[model samples]
Every structure is written in C-alpha cells, then in structure tokens.
Target chain A: MIDFAKDVRLWFAPSRLKDEGDTPDYRFSLANERTFLAWIRTALALVGGGFAVDQFLPDLRWGVRVGMAFALLAVGAACALRAVNHWVRCERAMRRHEDLPLSRFPVVLSLGVGLVAVAMVVVVLLGWTSGR
Target chain B: MSGPGTDRDAGLQPERTRLAWRRTTLASSVVAVLALRQALRGSGSSTEVAGAAVIVLIWLVFLWVAHRRIRALATGRPPGLAPRSALAVVGCTVALAVFAMAVIL
Candidate 1:
C-alpha cells in the first residue's frame, strides 16, 4: 500500500534539492516569485470574501448563502494549492532553460467567481420579489 | 560563494523578490486574522477556534521563513525556494474552509 502521507511530504519537498540546473537570469526568477505571491494574495482575498459572506451577509435563503460561501472557500483553497505548484514548475523550467508551463488557473478562478456572482444576483432578485 | 565581480542588477532582483515575499506574508496574515475573528464571533465553537489558531500559527511560521529568506537574499545567499511553508498555508486554508462550511451549515 502506498503511504499517502509520505507521498504528500515528498511532493512538497524543498526546491533546494540537487540544485542541478543552471541558474537562469535573476530577473526571471524574481518575476516568477512575484507571480506566485500575486496568486497567494488572490487566494487570500477569496478566503476573506468567503468569511465576510458567511458572517456578515443577511440570510438570503440559508442554503444559497451557505453554498456561495462554500464555493468561495473551496476555490480559495484550490488557488493556494495551485500557487505553490505553479511556482515550483516555473522555477524548474527557468533552471532548465525550457519554456514555462501554461497556467489554467485564471480561467478556473474567473469561472468560479463569475458563477458565485451570478448566484448572489439571483438571490438578491428573489429577495426583492419576496419583499424580504 | 562570491564571484569575482559584482553584477550590477543583483541587488535589485533580490530586493524585489524580498518585497514580493513580504507582501504575500502580509496578505496571508490578514486572511488569518479575518478567519480568527469570524470563527470567534460567528460560532464560538472549540473546533473552529482551534482551527483558526492553527491557521494563525501557520501564517506566523510562514512570516518567519519569509523574513529569513529576505535576510539571506540581502546577504547574497541563494534562496532555498522551498514551498513547504506555502503548502502549510494551503493546508490551513483547507481547514478554514471546513470551519466555514461547519458554521454555514
């Protein structure tokens, strides 16, 4: 049986191992790091939004409110996980003098946020009709 | 290892990277505090409180690691570039998500 815990630990191992590849231009590495940080900030914003919705928003149908909050929280968690993966992949690509990997996170993030926004709008409309 | 000649752009690159790291740490700390406050005020449950504490602790550790990396960068040391702390952040975020769901449900 595979030890999932050990696999996870190994997967997140420090990027200093071996240091085999040539160091690319410092600017490229710094840019990649900055991109990683940007993604982390985005994730943090999503998590904060989730908290705000859950804590502060008035009840617009408990199920819908909870669903919206859950979606934001899940997407935020996903963004955080993806940020580290993208950072490591970009660093490795730079070190190896290879093309950087393409990222689909933007698409995922936009779609998730767009869906949540639509849901909130619908809830607001329903509230207006119901006079609540 | 010091090379014979100093590169003109070396200082700026590390400084920029350090700033990015600091910005990320600040953002994560803000989220952690928000989570803590929401947990304390929304539910007041022991599990939620514990989860928020763990999240804050992880963010603190991340800040410490980032500070050390910034110092190393300033001194011309190669950054370790580890994602271990970043993963910890993600793990804590997942825990926070669970807490949020619990409160919502």
Candidate 2:
C-alpha cells in the first residue's frame, strides 16, 4: 500500500524546504494556501456585502455607491496583499535561517476594513437625513 | 536545506504574489461592475463605477509591484517590497462607506 504521507512528500518535493522549523513544512504550505483561499473568500464577501447595502435603502444616491465601491475595492486589494505576505513570511521563516520579518497583515488591514464598513453606515445615515 | 546563495527572491514568491494581486484586481472589477449596474439602473451607478475604477488603479499599481518582485525572486536575489500603505487603506474604507450610505438611503 502506498503511504499517503510519503506520496505527498514526493509530490511536493518537500526536500526543498528547510527541516528545522517548529511547524512542519507540509502543514505550513497547506496553511499558506488556505490563507490565500480565505482572502479570496473575503473578497467575495465584501462584494456581496456591497450588493446587499442597496437593498436596505432604496432611497439611494450617488455618493453611497461611490463610497461603497471604493471601500470594497480597498478591502479586496488588502486581502490579496495579505495572501502574498503570508506566503512570503511563512516561506521565509521555514526556508531561511534569518528571523522572520514583522508582519502587519490582517492586523493592519482588518482595522482599515472595519472603518470602511463604518463609513458605509455613515453614508446610510447621511442619505436618509438629507431626504434626497 | 536551502543551498548556498539562495536569496529571498530565489523561489516562487513573485509568481505567487502576482497571482494574488491579479485575483484582487479581478474581484475589484467584479464589484465595480456590480455597483455600476445597480447605480445605472437607479441613480448612483456612475459614482460607484468611478470609485471602483479608482480602486482598480490602486490594485494595478500593486500588480506592477508584484511583477517586479517576481522577477527579483526569479533572479535569486530577494528585493525589499514596501509594506502595504495604511493611508490607502483608510482612504478606500472612507470611500466605500460613503458609497454604501448613498445607496442605502
């Protein structure tokens, strides 16, 4: 019987990775890919969220759409940037003896996204109050 | 073990980051289209499209940077890429929030 772990090792050429990290290489790579997928999912969620915003307020105006589009676009770009950084950090930590560089990832971007979301709320309020 | 002379850019990062940025651009484009469709059908589509276009341009810059990184990686000398811009993030959030509010009310 083929050993699944051994087969995977051969397929991925795991030998390319350094052997001393606290985390396993295979697990690390998988985690990196999963992180990328999460970013993609987040991008989709923002898109959907942007779409849904219109449903709640039919009295919509141009400003809200413009703002929301920009916000969602920012969030999407951040997600992709996070994906790239995660891989870079993870790989560097595993492959190079050098210390892993500091990362700002979701830490910095998520907060920015949250604020954008708040802007979304503000826009709703402004539109409703203006009575346009 | 990574052999001697393996710089940071010696691996697949450029390709990976490029792909990541590409995905981001694609998603932004989709959202832009969605916003424009909604706005045009109603009264706010043009604004949404414009805002989204602005965001896309940002991603395009990101894409170019990623490509440069990829080439650096391919050459086996890691290049230092700047961290994500906080100002850009804040601006985008503010823009999106405003757009959403406009549409909802």
Candidate 3:
C-alpha cells in the first residue's frame, strides 16, 4: 500500500524551493495545503450533514434534496478553488517577501454563509410541507 | 520537516490531520447510518441512500488510512508512496451525480 501523503510531503519539501529563509514561505505554503484539506473535509461534512437532513425529512421533494446537495457541492467547489488561490498567493508572497493573503477568509466565508442561508430556506419549506 | 521548530514540530502536523479526519469520518459515518435508515425506510425510493452507505464506508477506510499514515509520518517511519486517490474520487462523484439524478428524478 503506497502512502501518497508522504509522497506529497516529499514533493513539496522546502529544500526543493529556490530560496529558504526565515520568512517561512515554504512553511506557509504547506500550511496552505493543510488548511485546504481542512476545507475539503468541511465540504464533505456538509454533504454528510445534508444527508442526515434527508433521513429525517424523507418525504422531502426534489427541490430540498437537490438544494441541499447544491449547497454542499458549492462548498466543495469553493474549497477547490481556494486551494489553488491560496497556494498561488503564498507563492507570490514568497517572491515579493510579503505576508500571505488574508482576504480569502471573508470572501469564502460570505459565500459559504450565503449558500447555507438559501439552503435553510429550501429545507424549511420542504420539511414544513413534508410534515403536513 | 525542514524548518526551525518544524523538525520537532513535525509530530503536530499529523495530529492535526488526524483530528480533521476523525471529525470528517465521524460525520460521514453518521451520514452512512442515516442513509441506511433511509434506505430501509424507502425514503424517496432513491438509490442515493445505498450509494451514500458505500461512499461513507469507503471514506471510513480512507480515514483509517489517513490516521495510520499520520502516525507513520510523525514517527519518521518510512511511507511507501501510494497512488493518488483523485481519479477514484472523481469517478465516485460522477457515479454520485448519476445516482442523484435517479433518486431525485
């Protein structure tokens, strides 16, 4: 059984970087990857969480099912894009000797929160209807 | 494993990863359990529930592997390179989309 994580670790080893410094660009980049993985996990959590909603709301219509799934899918897609965005920003920060980007949190958070809001409305309507 | 304190700190990374996977796996497992119930209950009469169970179980296995791998990396044990799981995940997702269509339609 091969271990891809280890391989990834080796592949991104800071020694491979052209410059190693106290600024810790490499460290930041690696942290970026770990954080991105965390987001992916969150996306999966949303998907799983959405399913649990389904179990209780079995009589739910397609809109609810699909709506919740759409929210989860959006979260997943956003995470993937954020992963690339983070890495690129980190790399650029290293080149410019600046801090890694800080703006992504607000953007992603707003997007995630917005989707949850819409999903909640759909769930409420569907769940309420199913109840009666 | 190539920075100040990072050498001594390498152990923390795996712990964090394990924690993330633990949380994710637990959530996914719950989904599986719930999906199984839905399947038995014939909720939506959708094939997605069965698919959910399979996805959850497979993810559980992946989580276990992730946990073990973190430990291996932390202790400086050799990690034989494994193939990327992306292709398989993508395939599972495509299957999921099709199943969702069947379930929802």
- Candidate with top DockQ is 1
Sort candidate 1 into its docking category: medium
* Pairs in clash, predicted candidate 3: A2-B81, A2-B82, A3-B81, A3-B82
Alpha carbon deviation, residue A71, candidate 3 (Å): 3.4
Q: Model 1: residues >4 Å from true position, as ranges?
A: A1-10, A15-20, A128-132, B1-11, B42-52, B77-80
Best TM-score goes to which candidate?
1
Best of the two (2, 3) by TM-score: 3
lDDT of 2 by residue, B16-80 (tens): 65455456445545554555555556454666667556655644554455455446435444333
- Which 10 consecutive residues of model 2 chain B have the lowest summed lDDT? B82-91
What does candidate 1's lDDT look like per residue over A35-131, in tens digits? Answer: 8778878877888788888777755556666777788888987887778777777777777778888877799789878988887787787773223
TM-score of each model's chain B: 0.67, 0.51, 0.49
- The CA lDDT at A64 in model 1 is 65
- CAPRI-style class, candidate 3: incorrect
Lowest lDDT block of 10, candidate 3 chain B = B80-89
Error of 2 at A80 (Å): 1.0
